[model samples]
Target chain A: MNNSEISEQGKLTIVGTGPGTDQLLAPAAKQALLEADSVIGYKTYVDLIRHILPESCDIQAYGMRQEVERSRAAAALALEGKKVCIVSGGDAGVFSIAGPVLEVISEEDLEKLNLSIIPGITSALSSAALLGAPLIHDFAVISLSDLLTPTELIEKRLSLAAEGDFVVVLYNPASKKRTELIKKCAQIMIEAGRKDTPVGIVRHGFRADQNVTVTTVSEMLNHDIDMNTTVVIGNSRTYRKGRFMVTPRGYAL
Target chain B: MNNSEISEQGKLTIVGTGPGTDQLLAPAAKQALLEADSVIGYKTYVDLIRHILPESCDIQAYGMRQEVERSRAAAALALEGKKVCIVSGGDAGVFSIAGPVLEVISEEDLEKLNLSIIPGITSALSSAALLGAPLIHDFAVISLSDLLTPTELIEKRLSLAAEGDFVVVLYNPASKKRTELIKKCAQIMIEAGRKDTPVGIVRHGFRADQNVTVTTVSEMLNHDIDMNTTVVIGNSRTYRKGRFMVTPRGYAL
Candidate 1:
């Protein structure tokens, strides 16, 4: 194996499963899971790939809001000379488990365990593909989950992204208890004079009950949005073409 | 076949090859290419997957700076009922061929040709994986190539992204003649109080001669940056840990 491959002594591989779809999962990520002695993740994300895990592979699935706990478990397993694979639903590097797992490893076992992060298809790009190419230019991805970040900061980002003419992708737009963040985000964008901008709302992308809608930013709040939804608000140049929403790359065609 | 699969007709499938690595390529994209009658892309990207293309598959590799011509060709080929696959080195939706191909088809043949876009690992996410999850928070992806976008707008986006505290990823950062854009972007970030932010520079990510460096934003310009490099500037919470650059997910560890 090359230098990029993990050595024999207890390695931790963080894999992104790519929108909970088997087909979207990268081959490298699949191989990591197949080779792992223990696979850990949130219960919902881990359930998505249970079919691919071997029977001998230990499946450690935790419930919601146990990110730190799962991360610590992953690091501890690797330190015990077990090849551990921690799974994240989308790309692990983007608002996912890689950071938390790395933080846990950095605390005490930085040298004993080998760490590798495998990239996956993030929701922004997957949603953009389903709605036509709305992120062809510069774009910003912000999560509306105020649990980690301040709501005011999220609002500021929405405003700035809109004013900069960025195609903005919003993850974790809303949850059951926090239903106002998406509405607030829409207000911030509209306040920045983006009321007419095209917005694509994709819920459970590439999964069962997947719904994709291309509408204007003004009408975005009228649709169904939840924690599973990914919202893409277009730049000034984005427009709807028949069933597709496209942002031109300014080619002189 | 599922509804997601194309019918037996002329179709255009835009595939993201994921940092030019076969292992990183998604199964959906690989399936699309394997079922394709003809494959077309920029010479560099096309050559990356040449080993996977069947001997009976017709290969059309175009030179650089021919995006419009290639998009038109892909659309024309699809209109004639040949399953054509256009490959992009990274995710096609991000500053690649998807938008151009969609735009070319939207002009007149929107209803005639079948189009499907399969997501892949973008350079930002792939480079972030190599750099140890520097993009675990909100991030902005901006391309420094001014071939299609105005320089002033690109500069404005960089400043806003920095001011908003987004981990910024720079794509197409510099070429032989376009060195000043990245330098200018560094100045903008520095002006926005990101001078000391952690910066990760990844060249030829997931490929031979891959180089990954973790440095501060102030020292980012001293690296060997070129068009093939992806630069990730960290947010205020990002820091270097041993060889890995990590942005915490605000989890109380």
Candidate 2:
């Protein structure tokens, strides 16, 4: 540890825990966890990897409503020279804590501590892999969560993805309060292009009880999907051959 | 081993060798190779994991034009119930021997040779991770090699990626015969959007001689980039703030 490392006694590494399994966590991520002094994350997420955490480690658990409080707690812990790991499901750098952690670090103590992000198996790529090759071409990832952004803004992204012939992956697709967003997304995609376009439903992808089903945009709108489900809607060239879903890597000449 | 183990013999688990390092290779991929009866890949790639490959296992080498022939040889070995590991750099599924071997697997010999593609880090993702955060939003990945697709089709995809506000990653951007395609790509991106958009030329992204530079779309046209480089053209949100190249993930929502 150099001057920068020593001055900032408390360091932070935000990690993506991967999809509900230890086997999926990258080796670097596993090593980082062992080096941490304190671990912080939502209680549900914390529970998933509690067994691996060291006996001397302190855990700061947060609930659904206490976002600010949780961030503050983690920050204060880091300021005290504790090695902190901000845990998030999937890759931390995505829709997870990467932004928030970076935000608090810059504002609170960038000069005092070290901060790095460890990439893990992002759910979008994981889902695409499990359901054949929907992401072999260009793709778009959008969060259906309207908690921060308005529903209108999400629609704009969907329109852009559809018009560009980009494969689209929906995250936070159908929370209890946001159930209608996924349906609205399907309607917009249908308006932009083909209704018969292939749609893949991978609920709990790479996790226990992982459900994979393929349907078209038309049929999917009528089907029930939940927050756990990651919906992959294929571009114009996407097709289904028997049980395998295939997305061409553009037509080879 | 038991009768079940004997029947499952000559198994082939094709693993991605990562872009070019030992640490980047997944633990599962390492395990698969240790368990393999024979490992086959391009001679160069096999050398990376030379220490781990068992002396008892047969090692086969193939050169540039010999990939198809190598796949056939590996599949034939798998048919005899040998645990075959056909290696490719980066993810086995992405433009590698994984799909080719799957295409060659005989339905009759399916039981004898179980083919599983163990994912390794893909070059696009590996490069993106190294160069700040080009993959923070929707993106397009296009290979400039016109061997399979026409140059015109590749150009069309480039246009679409720029128009769609994708942080495009250009692989095989330049080769001996095709020197100016990267410049042409920069020109199209400039026409599609703001000329000042940041473009990153990352050579050997995760290797020892890693060189990363951020230049505008206009500068990239004249900038020297080679086949070893992965060019990242930022979307609308890409900006140059001092020494670092950034593709902001919507700047704090």
Candidate 3:
């Protein structure tokens, strides 16, 4: 159960490769992938770093939403003395594989598994970078996906964030089957006295088909939003500066 | 102000070096430093990545809490046809140099200076990775430093995050002079029905002297905390699993 004991056993590492770009991947993440004996992840995220992955490593791809099954498989491999790795698109700890991987490892096997989680640039940070610093102040990150969390809780959180004047970043904004949650989110913010707040939308962040736009909260619905999009609703002080959306850090200058 | 015209001029990039470690720094951030004609940052952050910076790049180091002056200097160098880079300790956009740098560049000179903000792994993500998956769901990031933001606003955010049951990440938890704010934060959370909530504190994250601990919100004050510490107060469902602190994503086993 000690550090030395865990090092002698098989290790399971959860690596975040950033927003599907080689340049955005952290050196620690790249090092994890290079030294991995086997790699497992969702098909889309695996494809993002296919070029950076070592050819000697065994690769396994799972269909979307099969997190439970994939996690168990990766845990099993690590239990059998294989150096296993699970890749997440953004930071592993941010709505990614770290939770599932940690959840599947039983309490008894917790000490036996040498687990390592490496952080990466999450979508919110990348989206903020493209939009020119919309998160320079206090912020909240919320997901619109109701499959795991209840919609009512999401609404309460949105209202509280608005009331506290926290810049809000939303993940999984809209998909083919679920479009109403984002609409409800926009309505909640607008009704909470944020109708004129600056909103930055970055779809497919750091990718080839990336789209970045700055708009007011009232006009956010007119933009193209989908599953790949990240929406940042700015705080009261956030503003549009030419082509960039900025939130000042309360400096006198 | 068009894309082509802006590309033809000098560019200023605000780089996030990621928790003072070479391996944690993003490849894009390193590339920016490698190609930078001039590099400017606070002494602490600049020293974190000084070895990686190329010899030809002009280095400028500023004292602490001089963001306004440092930002203006970086902007002026970029205006004079230099590839200037301003580095921040964590992600540039997360309570770091991105705001000051963006704020200093006026609208008239905005087109003349091509600006690029490169995202890095913020301390919250690095801190979460070290202590296990404490940010797997909705969360709010608030700094305890009251120099820029008012104390009342920070208390409101702490209360709102606790009421919503969103995991909360606190940066700049305590310093020599500003120790009361973090104590106030713990009291606020405990008052909002989070008395025994799991709390993970990672100090000097990803560094040689890194320290990680998991405790309860009520007992968090017993531990050592300072400006280098990033505290992660867990949501309602978070729990301590052996040495790791985990927040489940509500997945059905």
Pairs with steric clashes in candidate 1 = B10-B81
Which candidate has the top score in lDDT? Answer: 3
Give me the displacement of residue A25 in model 3, in angstroms.
0.7
Which candidate model has the greater lDDT, 1 or 2? 1
Give chain B TM-scores in order.
0.94, 0.90, 0.95
Evaluated at residue B31, the lDDT of candidate 2 is: 84
By lDDT, the candidates rank as 3, 1, 2
Q: Which of candidates 1 and 3 is the stronger one according to DockQ?
A: 3
How many steric clashes does model 3 contain?
0
TM-score of 2: 0.84
Off by over 4 Å in 1: A1-8, B1-8
Best-to-worst order by TM-score is 3, 1, 2
Give model 3 RMSD, 1 decimal: 2.4
In CAPRI terms, model 2 is classed as acceptable
- How well does candidate 3 score on lDDT at residue A201? 93
Query: Against the unseen true structure, what C-alpha lDDT does each candidate score?
Result: 0.89, 0.71, 0.90
